[model samples]
Target: MCSLEKRGDVFILTITGDSDHRLNPELLDSITAAVAQVKSESTPSTALITTAQGKFFSNGYDQAWALSDPARPKIISKKLRLLVEDLISLPMPTIAAVNGHASAAGFILALSHDYLLMRRDRGYLYMSELDIGYPIPRWFVQLVRSKIGSPKIWRSVVMAAAKITAEMGVEWGIVDSAHNGIEATVEAAVKLGADLVGRKWGGEVYAANRRVVFADVLAVLGSDETVGDSGDADVASVMNHKL
Candidate 1:
């Protein structure tokens, strides 16, 4: 589902394939495992860049798979929540080389990074829940609130479900930079990662500061309360709406 490669002090975690890297159980587990590996093996100067080899960075949750089992939605939601926690607590700086479309959960995954570099040639950042009639999760709202500074932009994203392009993403402060293509975006991310690694910042110290900065987000993710009970009934409701 994914592979990790180290290039000097920068580690690249790539979701390999031309398909939309759907956030399913297997894929989520693979990503979480990769993050754990990065944590265990990282040095002070190490940095991470997550990218995908495809036309889609990730389309979103694997709804078809989610609908197959009543408990699956909550399972995937919990996994995503934990993965966000892992990314936030990661010692080294993180960047997302968004080479393709990032929708819903995929958007959240990209936003979990410390910085984002997107391709200008194609792809868009989109939050599809509103359009699809799904209630946006509370933790997701909090996370988006933390990342997006403008209330107007936040509304556009969560309420209007605007498909944000690379130029707009940079202009709106959602992404650090925009590049010409997928390879260019990844290159920019790697360069940015290298620059961050050059700072030689202590992993523990950086992670600690990040915790302090996003303490509210962390708390919400840890909380029991969500948009719903995240139970079978909740999953059923969600599926019904989709239908």
Candidate 2:
């Protein structure tokens, strides 16, 4: 379901759909382990690119996983969320090449990366958390605030049940850069990583700077938008109607 390619020290982790790039538990575990190994094994001036093999980067968790084992949803969701948190906190640089629709938990996963580059012209990215009866988690909103600001835009994305479009993403600044397609996005991200790498502090300086920027947002997530919330009004709420 996923393949790890190493060029020099750069690790390109491409997630292929199960059959059609579908999600699988074992595949996810392998991807997570590859990331962990890269973090531990690679040296400075290294980079990681999280992208896809087929049209999409991911379709969130496998529908079959939930349907087949209804009782395991909570455990599975929690584990995936925590893994994403780890990905966000990784010491090395990370990039998200959003090749296609990134919905549900996939949005959360993309948000965890340091850089998000997308194929804007392809209508490639959408956040469908609200449509899935999933509550808006604090981390998700914090990511938006980290990129945009604290305003109606954030609430519209969070509380109002809205799907942020690619053009809107460019305006909001959540995506570091947008291009005509995935190839363009990757080229730009590679250049971005090249400019970022070999710098003093190994990109930790920028990561630290984000703490100052996200002070309030982080505090909000600590309370009302915890990863374990699953679904609740204050932190998360379910909805089916369109915004």
Candidate 3:
């Protein structure tokens, strides 16, 4: 489901296939392994760019698979949360080359990165839980809250289920920039990586700084004993709503 390649100090992780790139167990495992590979291979000068093939960056969790197995949902959720935490703490600078639609968990995945670049010609950054009849997870809300600074954008995304285009994403501080297509987005990410590498920051320090910046998210992710009292009421109600 993913491939890792190195071009000098920049590591490109691409999620392959024409599939929707859902976060099933197998795919999630593959992604976790890929991140581990990047961590092992990276140096102080190295950086990482995550992109995908075809029209989907990721469509979120594989609902059909989750429905088939009763326990799959919790497993997928925990794994995804851990994956985002891993990405946030990855030792090198990270950028998301959002090639296409990033919906639901996919949106959160992109937000987890240090920078986000999208294709202006196609695709959208959508929080699709409302439309899909799924509850948005509390950790995900923490993610949006940490990464995105605009309250208007937050309400629009979590409550209105806004389908944010590339340009709108940039305006809302959700994405760093918008490019013409997948190739352009990746190229820009590569260039950004190169520039950021020139800062000469140690990977460990960089990762630690990120942890501090997103300390709240880390706290929630590590909180296994906590229950209730998260995010907002209206959204949490819908998220915990039983069908």
Best by TM-score: 1
| Model 2 TM-score, all chains together | 0.77
Residue-level lDDT of model 3, residues 1-243, one tens digit each, is 899998878999999999989888899889899999999888876799999999999988776776554445667777887898899889999999999999988888888899999999999999987887776667788988987778887999999999999999999988899999898999999999999988888999999999999999998885321123343343333334221
What TM-score do all the candidates reach, one by one? 0.96, 0.77, 0.91
- What's the lDDT for all of these models? 0.89, 0.63, 0.84
In model 1, state the lDDT of residue 32: 94
For lDDT, candidate 1 versus 2, the one ahead is 1
Could you give the candidate ranking by lDDT, starting with the highest?
Answer: 1, 3, 2
Clashes of 3: 1
Clashing residue pairs in candidate 1, if any? none
Off by over 4 Å in 3: 223-243
lDDT of 2 by residue, 1-243 (tens): 577777655678887653434445676677788788777766656778888755666656565654444343444455565566556556667888877767656766677677888877654445566655665556566666675565876666666646666677777766777788778877777777666665634535554655455555445543433324454332222222221
Q: Give the per-residue lDDT of model 1 (tens digit) for 1-243.
A: 999999999999999989888898899999999999999999977999999998999998887888888777778888988999999999999999999999989999999999999999899999988888887888889889999999999999999999999999999999899999898899899999999999999999999999999998899886434324657767666755431
Best lDDT among the predictions, by candidate number: 1
Candidate 3 Cα RMSD (Å): 4.1
User: Which regions in candidate 2 have their CA more than 4 angstroms from the true location?
Assistant: 18-24, 142-144, 203-243
Error of 1 at 177 (Å): 0.5
